[model samples]
Structure formats: structure tokens, C-alpha cells
Target: MTVELRVLPPLLVSLAVTVVLAACTRVPPPPPPESREGFPERGARLIQQYGCGGCHTVPRVPRAEGLVGPPLTRFGARSYIAGELPNNAENLRRWIQDPQSVEPGTAMPDLGVSETDARDIAAYLFTLE
Candidate 1:
């Protein structure tokens, strides 16, 4: 009597299906976009409109060329404002509203950002990191 062994093929196929299903089940969806609660798209537009990037190396703005001010690539992650005030949205807004008030000798000018604009700019800046 001769016995045929067809069991190995089915076992291999079952194992492959199990592996594929496992792989598919384990994958996670991508994370959602960062919150823009305080940051509005208009603020990003204003950043360009006001030419803030000309003096500061603002992220995501193009044609920005000026060496007058400090680079602001990581301004959001900074711990202090002008090396004095605590790094917070309110402080950033105040600084933007009036830089000289924060630091008497600082060369950063007041861009005439309104309360709303300042908030938006601060929100955008906070997203740098």
C-alpha cells in the first residue's frame, strides 16, 4: 500500500496565509496632522506677506534672505524669549507685538502685528518644532 502525503502543501499555504493576515492586522494607521488650534493658515500667509523671513530664517518660507536677525528654525523649541522671558505662546505674542518692550536693546522691530495677527504668528512659530 502506498500513501500519498499532500499534507505539507496545505500546511505551508496555511502558514503563509496566517503570516499575511498577521502582517496586515499589525499595521497601524498614520498619525493625524498636527493641531492648528491657534495657528491659522492665514498666519502662515502673513508671515510671507510681512517678509518676516527676510530677517529670520523662518521655516517653510521661500525667498527669505536677510542676515540681520537670528535664525528662527527652532524658535518654537526654544526655552526662553530673547534669553529672558519664559518660552510660551503669550510671551511670544507679546514679543511679536513689541520686541523692544521685551528687550530694550534688541534690534528686532515691531512688525505692527495686531493682537490677532500676533496670536496667529505665535501659533505658527510654535509649529516649527
Candidate 2:
């Protein structure tokens, strides 16, 4: 019993230290998929086609000045979507597909965006950084 108690304390301490150290270390997320490459250009075209400029002020997009919705100038650096969901590729795509679903009664209408188009749009949005 005495031997076990001494050994257990040291083992527990070592385990706790290991866990703390591991938690303190961070591993960066992997790079975006290769298939998403060359999508920004297409996404830019889609944005223009969708008339997104009618609502938000998008950088590099001509006549993308409006006061209805929030500006998407630094959209890529934003941390949240509609200030609700995390600003990731998947969430962005979902929001693009169905803004009402993500946030009911939102002014941003669902443009019936297809999955491929959503992905491309996301790629372009992330490029704003």
C-alpha cells in the first residue's frame, strides 16, 4: 500500500504535466483543398452575376457599394457568419445556399446557390485577406 501510494502520486503528476503540455501546444489547420484552386476567379464572376454588389461593398468588385447589408470587404478575416456560425468554408457555403436557414428573417435572401458555386464563392471570399 505505501509503495503504491508513492508511485501513484508521481505517475499522476507526470500524466497531468503531459496533458498540460499537450494542451498548450497548437497545430495549425491543414491547407485548403487543391480542387478549390482557381476558384476565386470563377467565384468573382459568380459574385458579379449574383449581384452581390447590390447589397454589400466588396473590394475589387465594381459598383459594389450599398448600404443595405454589411460590407464584405474583410470577409475573409471575419470569424463568424452573420455573426452566428463560425466563418469556415462549410459554414460560408451553407450561408450562401440558404441565408434564411442560417438565420431566419435575415435580409440576405437565398439565391439558390448550388454547392459548386458556394464552394467557389467561399474560395473567393477567403481571398479577401
Candidate 3:
């Protein structure tokens, strides 16, 4: 075989590797529009209404541009909440409903989020992943 033919196999392998890597690192798309009263959508609305954006930078939430607290750009992927509690749906809900209970000196105050609203808010936060 000629030199070009000898290099074809390696070139093809490299191209395949690049394609696989690209696919692996691909970013997830945005969630679809609110569907039949989904908690995530409801939670998003509640977040805005409750002025959550006044403190934290929630991704994709309208007017969620506050800089008082930590930015929630990829909150679902975080390992901990409030830099203490493990990052989980239950923990998120608990923290949302009552921050002072979790961390006495925490800047995040108890916003009086009801259990249902807390659940919905957590659901929406997890969607950021």
C-alpha cells in the first residue's frame, strides 16, 4: 500500500474519537415549556414570585439575576447545599423551607416556603442540571 493508504486507518480512528468525545461533552438542552402543571414549571414561577432572584442567580429563571447569594447556575450538580448539607432533593426542600434550622447563622433566611412550594422549588432547581 502507498503512504496515504497506510495513514488512512489512523486518520479515521482519530476522527471517530473526536466525534465520541464531542458527544460525551454535549450540553443538555433546555426543558420544554410548562406541561400540564409540572412542579418544575410551577416552582420556577414561585421562585420569581417569591423574589428568590433577589439573592441567588438561578439559571434560566426570569429576573433571577440577584447577586446577594451564591449563583445557582448548575445547582443540581453541586455536592452540597449551603456548603453543608448534602445536595439532594429532600435536603434542598428542607433548606428552602427553613434555612436557619439547617444552619443557624446562614444568610438564607426562612422564606416561609410551604411544603408543597418547597418541593416544587427543589424540583425546579434540580432541572438546572
Candidate 4:
């Protein structure tokens, strides 16, 4: 029992010293801040990529001042889209993805935009308000 007690204290002290050394050696990095969802940024890129500016005169989009179609400056505040469908997210995405499906004789062409891209573009356009 006497032999065991002498050795146990040393072992415990060594273990504690090792733990302290490890703690002092390197500092843990601070937790990263939650990144903002890249919704607006991604939406703007998609809008420009699909050439929406070709017809619609969208504000905040460089060189998007086309006069062929209706100006989408305050699209979010608008009650209707193309004077046909409601201006909600789902409707906006549907219109962007496939305009012909929404309106038979509409001038807006189906730009073949993906569902995700359409959603993102709509999210960005909504920010106009």
C-alpha cells in the first residue's frame, strides 16, 4: 500500500502537467461567424446570366435598362406579374422558369432557367422593394 501511494501521486501529477502543457501549447481558434445566405448575390448573377435585362429594364443590374419589356424596378411591390399571374415567389419562379406555360400568347419567352436559379432570381428581385 505504501509503495502504491507514492507512485500514484507522481503519476497523477505527471498526467496533470501533461494536460496543462497541452492546453498552453496552442489556443483553439475562435468559432466562425455564421455566413449570410448568398441569396441576393446568387439571384443577381442568375438574372444577368439568363439575359433578363434583354427585355425587362431591371434596376440595380448594370446594363439592364432594356425597353422591350416592362420595367421590373419595384417588382416585389407589384400586385401582378405580366398583368396575368400573382406576384408571389412560386408564381415568379414559375414565370421565370417557363413563361409560355403561364401565358399562351405572352411575349415573354421561356428562358429555360432552372428551378433553383428562378427561385434565387426571384429572391433578388424581391429585394428591389
- Of the candidates shown, which would achieve the greatest lDDT relative to the real structure? 2
Provide TM-scores for the models: 0.67, 0.71, 0.69, 0.68
User: What would the per-residue lDDT of candidate 4 be over residues 1-129, giving only the tens digit for each residue?
Assistant: 999999999999999999999988976533221222237788888778888888888888877878889898877677677777767787778888888888887888887888878878888887776
As for candidate 1, its clashing pairs are: none
TM-score of 2: 0.71
1-129: candidate 1 lDDT, tens digit per residue = 122357777888999999999988955533322334476567677788888877887877776556788777766667777887877877778898999998997888887989888888778887777
Q: Candidate 4 has which clashing residue pairs, if any?
A: none
Ranked by TM-score, the better of candidates 3 and 4 is: 3
- Cα deviation at 43, candidate 2, in Å, is 0.6
Model 1 TM-score, 2 decimals: 0.67
| Model 3: worst 10 consecutive residues (lDDT sum) | 29-38
> What is the Å distance of residue 2 in model 1 from its true position?
72
C-alpha-based local distance difference test score of model 4 = 0.78
Total backbone collisions for each predicted model = 0, 0, 0, 0
In candidate 2, how many Å is residue 107 off?
0.3
Ordered from best to worst lDDT, the candidate numbers read: 2, 3, 4, 1
Give me the displacement of residue 108 in model 1, in angstroms: 0.6
- lDDT score of residue 47 within candidate 2: 87
Superposition error at 100 for model 2 (Å)? 0.7
Clashing pairs in 3: none
